[model samples]
Target: MYSRSIMAVSSWNDNGQKQFVHDPYELYRSDFFPGLGWMLARSTWDELSPKWPKAYWDDWLRLKENHKGRQFIRPEVCRTYNFGELGSSLGQFFRQYLEPIKLNDVQVDWKSKDLSYLQEDKYAQHFANIVAKAKPVSGVNVLQETNNIDGDVRIKYRDQSDFEYIAGQFGIFQEWKDGVPRTAYKGVVVFRYPSTRARRVFLVGPESLKLLRITDS
Candidate 1:
């Protein structure tokens, strides 16, 4: 169960809207609340059970303070795939979004992995350095050079519109929740691109670096 707890928030679209997206195989930490196949400690359950929402418990959990300062391990590729094609939303996004998710097939020894770096304090610093060191690329034209780049790259987006435009180009998730994209860490979304290499692309918000101290003087 401990290893399974490391699973990503695969389904349960909160907005009830369709926005096609896809993910790759990688691991990162973020605040995206898990919808299904999640584990909870008995003690933690004791604390939250009293305040459980009568309806939309998942949306309630999306609130920051509810899971604030808590480190959640989510994978770039979802651990579980949702097969329900009919629901309240009437399968609106099923064909475009949910239907295409590639379930993780790699058997990883999660128990042996060092997850200490994923802790709040440690991950913040570690991720900040990664974003800072990433080669900066601007405009969709420049993105064509990624095939030749040697390391991780970062693309800065001025706003939600810009983010959607850039995300559309790379064919990744573009929806935002509370001003943050899915699988985001510190206002940046991480995903491996081109589907054939190990290099990752970081779609960073304008204020992300400042918030992460990557731009602090």
Candidate 2:
């Protein structure tokens, strides 16, 4: 649906294919493109709500009117724009504050047969103890060990999830080496989207080889 408030400009792509460009003065207001308008609208609302009083609604409308249709929407340029940051931030805010009311009424199955045996296992107790004692810093989630390569174990977390970390943050992994219990600081790596395959490489440190439990050929 074309908005009466905004102007649409049709242009040709690299293959000389005709495309309609929706130019909304605000990057967030352009609905001609998918998901762009929604992101901008939400972000702008969040940023403006606290500052703008109820009396400022007319001003908001005027701002939209003046900027609409004059802006250019270039599809090629849009590809380079970062939407992950906005999407992740909005998702986190919604999940924390506005999760569905139905979710509150749903009952959790605490006595499931799958988890019944976990209560009786000493190994589970040890694992739980380890988890309880482990303090997670901002970026580090889990530290695991692998023998596949010099920098095998990855420090996994979505950067856009309000959890921020540098590339070289050290994580300590507790595992068995030569039949002896050992703990070593392995390398850290962030997770990226579109490549959700297992064993995704993030960061490999020089010391990662020294911390390996098994020697790689």
What is the TM-score of each predicted model, taking all chains together? 0.77, 0.18
- Stretches of model 1 off by over 4 angstroms after superposition: 1-26, 88-92, 140-150, 215-217
Computed on alpha carbons, the lDDT of every model, listed in order, comes to 0.65, 0.27
Inter-residue clash pairs, candidate 1: none
lDDT (10s digit) by residue, model 1, range 66-98: 665453566666666777888743465766566
Whole-model alpha-carbon lDDT for candidate 1: 0.65
lDDT of 2 by residue, 25-92 (tens): 11122112222222224444565567565753422422433334222122211222223535543675
What residue runs in model 2 are displaced by over 4 Å at the alpha carbon? 1-185, 190-193, 196-199
